[model samples]
Target: MARSLRYFSPRRECPFITIDLGSIPESLFESELFGYEKGAFTDARKAKAGRMEVASGGTLFWMK
Candidate 1:
C-alpha cells in the first residue's frame, strides 16, 4: 500500500522510469526479481525469466 502514492504523484524526474506496485504477490518475491533457473532450488519446477530481464531495456524503480 505504501507504494501506491508514487502513482498519484505528479512531480518526478523527467528521465526516470516507474513500474507499478499493485498486483504483486508476496510469494513471487524470490522468483520475480532475481532470475533462478529450474532445479536451482527444490520448489522451482520450471525455468522462467525474472523482472530484471523484463526491465532490461528500461529503468526499473522499486519503491522502498
Candidate 2:
C-alpha cells in the first residue's frame, strides 16, 4: 500500500520513505523517528535527519 501510494503520488519529485517498526529496537525508535541535534546526545557527533525530516514535503510510511 505504501509503495502504491508513493508510486501514484503527484509529487514524484519528492521522496518516499518506509520504516519497518518491527525491525527497529524500541530503545532506538524515538531517535530514529525524530532525530536529534549534533550535541543532543553523548555520541551524536553530527546532526542527522530522521525519517520524518527526510520525508518532509513527501511521504512517510511505517509498518509494524
Error of 2 at 26 (Å): 1.5
Q: Compared to the true structure, candidate 1 yields what TM-score?
A: 0.48
lDDT of each: 0.61, 0.86
* lDDT by residue for model 1 (5-61), tens: 544555322223444455567777767777689998888898887777765654467
lDDT tens digits, residue span 2-45, model 2? 67766777856798888999999998899999888899878999
Which residue pairs clash in candidate 2? none
Model 1 misplacement above 4 A: 1-31
Error of 1 at 16 (Å): 10
How many clashes does the backbone of model 2 have?
Answer: 0
